[model samples]
Target: MSAAAAVLREEIGGQPAVWRALVARGAQVAEVAAALDALDPPLVRIAAHGTSDHAGIYATYLLRALRGWTVVRDSMSMPLYYGSPAARPGELAVGISQSGETPDVVAWLERAGREGATTLAITNGEGSSLARIADHVLAIGAGAERSIAATKTYTGTLAAIALLAGQLAGRGPQLADALVATADAADALLDGLDAAVAPVAAALARIDRMYLVARGIELATANEVALKLTEVCYLGAKAMSATAMAHGPVAALDADVPLWAIAAPDATLPAVAEAVRRARAAGAPVIASGPAAAALDGAAFALPVPVVPAEPLLSPLLSVLPGQAFAWALAGAKGIDAGAPRHLRKVTSAA
Candidate 1:
């Protein structure tokens, strides 16, 4: 393998260890959760960008479903450009950044802190600016990520969000165990990537664009995976919730444009399956991934992921692995450096 692909693979291979470390350091999350519980915020406002924004989306669904907190994905523009506070006094404001140095995110959290909201920073950077600015911090423990594509940090952020949400919801122990199990599942998936993801990557290497569809919490997976493909493989990958796809985007599907469907065995499976049916009927190749992917009829590729048992919300922790691996493998197949994409930097600074 080229050095570029090797760098990306090494980081991806380290996710299991990152998650295990996060679980081992449960006290950090507990402290943040305790602070949150004491504040008893009426709502949550999350500030993030790019991949971190996708993690925020995952946290939005998890926090609302698990703890009944109304969560909002705050567009930093509201505060940075318009001088409006993203959070009210006594509300919870979260800033998510892999580097913990995103200018807009830092500015938003600063505004929240000034507004008397409790600020929390979820990031891999423990002593970074975002961590220092927040009232509390939960480090993802991804450990010195070198690849610009952000494989481990993304998963690490999701794991951190799960731990925090689980703690607030009073299911910390159970969720921690499930997360450790997810780490093991991720290890096994990495061990078998050649068998599972190589063929799919080879088949998709020639395609210029694709669609990723999912619903509920897994919609975050679709969006993140689409971003990965766009960044690494340089594809025009669009992501949409299944309901949104059915509305009008279904018309754009055809044989040349493939569709990747993430259908975990949860409340959204029926609608996701229906979306798969529509994609197939449109003659688009359907690549399915999730715990219940095998059950999707007529899919061109079915990548069945490990089920997290009773914790369906934790499925994204496992479901997103194949998409990550596919991006790396497809980049290799297309002779592109997965670690170094054009016109991008590790830390993006936008106002």
Candidate 2:
């Protein structure tokens, strides 16, 4: 690999090790679950910055669906930029940061902590600032990431959040086994990266802009991958729900802009299929993923992901892997620096 792409190769390929590391720390994961078990779901809020926020939202979607509790993603602008008083009386506030030190994330959790909330930090840096301020911490064990575009840390956070959400939903006993299985599946995907690169990159090789569509919880994956394509590969990618894309963006579909759809195994599959139908009708290429893959065979390219038993909660973690691979390979093909993009940093702080 060229020096420009080496970090991308190393960090993305290292995800299996990260997964195993997080699993080996099962006792620590259990501690995070125990802390969530003590709190009332209605009193819970999660604060995070950038891609970390996507991880929290993915977990929040699962927690809300499984347990029927409203968990909000606290908008950091209230405390950091607007200078408004922090919302009070939250029983728990979870902050997520790969470095555990994004200024806004730390400050929001600190204010929430002062207002009688128990703060928990989910991060890779066990001893970073957020960890010090938090009442609890769940380290991602992804080790040191060198790529400007996050690969391992994002997935590590995904697995960690799934654990906490599963525990909170009273599915605690099954979480570890589920996580292990998830990790195994992820390993298979990464291990086959050499085989995957050719097809995935070919699917994405020509596009300058495209819509990555998902519904329900999988939106988190779509949004994160869109950011990755832009930040790392200089692709003008957009992420939106299939329903939204079907209503408006579908009209813009043509051969020049394809539709990349994520159809998780849920009630939302019909909506996703509808979007795919619309795109194909408009002469746009379609590439789909998720369970019930046969339903999407009419697409120009299809990567049928098996419905893992750990799904719904673990779907985004599974679904996002293809996007990461595609973006990295496409970047390399385009001669862009997939590891280090211009004007981007591994740790962003100002906002």
Candidate 3:
């Protein structure tokens, strides 16, 4: 098996363990909500790179929903690079680093904090440079993630972001309850994932490229799936705004290419469903991964749980697990050692 796949077996061991983490994540959200009240910044900024971009995006959406504070979320535009150059000096800089030592995140936050902005580092490492540099620190209780693909850390980050979002919007009670609800769903979906394994595995051996399509909050889930596929399975995967797919990438599909549609319980589902039909008519193998029950010409791997509500912008968390499981299965099938990748280290100190 690929190292990445091995890590899944080692980490999850079974569906119950994974489900337990999801359950605790709900409680963690309440804790996170309580923590965010301490940082009443007029402006909030999420500064992150690589896979942590998912966290930044989630935080941005959640904050906007819970507290009307203006949020600026940044992510690397290219590999091994910092985020967008649109960093403002007035906002609270929230830096996210799994190892807590990404040089770009560290450098940006350090500079921002030095410029008089309150900085917060959300990380698993309590002793990393960011933890030491930021004015405040929110530690993710995901424990050690030996696998490089970042399963638990990603979920933990989302939980932390949800809490921050709730606090900023003065929706602490609502956000806490939402987290608990989402976690319950996450656990049920993880425990009953067997229903998806067969179809996911069937698609893995038959396709060359994977296209994850979604709109609105579902776009974040699409991005996370694409990242997991590329990072662990070492495959070619792309995420597109469902409408954007109609313009260009749609021309590149065929039966050899498999598409995964992110169908959420929202208005965007109709358009995303149409996109799946377009790909299928062009002879592409498509899989639906969301709350939707059926697909026109493809298989639908519906989650065992229901979708969560979070103002339209926060729908990403509900579908994140299904995509994660799909990627994890593909990685295992290929025997790729997902804990590490080519020419990459856990920490980049060169910057």
Cα-based TM-score, every candidate: 0.97, 0.93, 0.83
Candidate 3: where is the Cα deviation over 4 Å?
Answer: 1-4, 10-42, 75-89, 293-305, 309-315, 335-344, 347-351
Model 3 has an lDDT value of 0.68
**What would the per-residue lDDT of candidate 2 be over residues 1-351, giving only the tens digit for each residue?**
567588787777777677667777878877877866766645568887668888877867876776666788878888778887555675678888999878888889899889778788999889898999988998898988877788899989988777667676777558767777877787777677556656767656777888888888888988898888888778888989888985677777899888888887778888888888888889988878655446865787766555678554676777887778778888877777787788877775545
- Candidate models: Cα lDDT each: 0.89, 0.79, 0.68
Judged by TM-score, which candidate is best? 1
lDDT per residue as tens, model 1, 1-351: 778678898888788899999999999899889989888888899989889999999999999988999999977898789877677998999999999999888989988999999999998889988989999998988888888898899999999999998999999999999999888888998899757889998887799899999988998899999999999999999999987888889999999899999988868899999999999999999999988898789999988788888577888988888899899989989989998998988875553
> What clash count does candidate 2 reach?
0
lDDT of 3 by residue, 1-51 (tens): 555557764553333343345445655545554555665667777778766
Number of clashes recorded per candidate: 0, 0, 11
- Model 3: weakest 10-residue lDDT segment is 11-20
Q: Pick the lDDT winner.
A: 1
Residue 38 lDDT in candidate 3: 65
State the lDDT at 154 in candidate 3.
Answer: 72
Residue pairs in candidate 1 whose N, alpha carbon or C atoms collide under 3 angstroms = none
